[model samples]
Target: MNLKFIKRNIFPLVKIISTVLITSAIGLESWNIYAFLTNRNVPSSLNPIFWIERFAMTSHFIESIIAAFYAHSGKKMPIQYATYTFFVGTIGLLELFDQEND
Candidate 1:
């Protein structure tokens, strides 16, 4: 593939994918956090079937929150930050950092 083609395609593709992933992450994390705070989430129910998902979500939430703080404090973005921000799913830290960088 040509550099020109890649340059045109990849950035836009990345933006689109990142936007979608981040949005979903925010939604899911928020939902899980709410459910968790109220003790109504599946994890709280102690269903074996939900354990993996709960564990994954919990970890994701933890990572994302840390990433958010890191991004907010003007630190470099780690690959994990992308994962976290994507999971955090809000529109704040990413936009803040993007504007700060620009």
Candidate 2:
């Protein structure tokens, strides 16, 4: 059980786990919105559609944070790091648009 070998194996595992968790969170958030719309009445003051959009955007923000962490873990190749960084930037832009609408 060399410490270096353990680290080498664990870090990539962590990145994969992080990516899966982020994707799951996005899916769950979307499902929540769908459930709200299909089964319940919408509130008059806050539009359910807009609220769902904002919630989805917030989930993207969380996904961006996960991507940033995975990128900074220093376990991935340069290309992988760049790819995660690009996702983070795209999520941030979506969040900004959501904020502007609210």
Q: Clashes in model 2: which pairs?
A: none
Could you tell me how far off, in angstroms, the CA of residue 10 lies in candidate 2 after the best superposition?
1.0
Per-residue alpha-carbon lDDT of model 2 for 11-102, expressed as tens digits?
Answer: 45755665675566566557667878889654555557556656655755665555545543444444554446343444333333444455
RMSD of each: 8.0, 12.3
Scanning candidate 1 in windows of ten residues, the lowest lDDT window is: 87-96
TM-score of every model versus the real structure: 0.42, 0.39
Q: Highest lDDT among the candidates is held by which one? A: 1
Give the TM-score comparing model 2 with the true structure, all chains together.
0.39
- The pairs that clash in candidate 1 are 25-87, 26-88, 26-89
Question: Judged by TM-score, which candidate is best?
Answer: 1
* Residue-level error in angstroms, candidate 2, position 69: 14
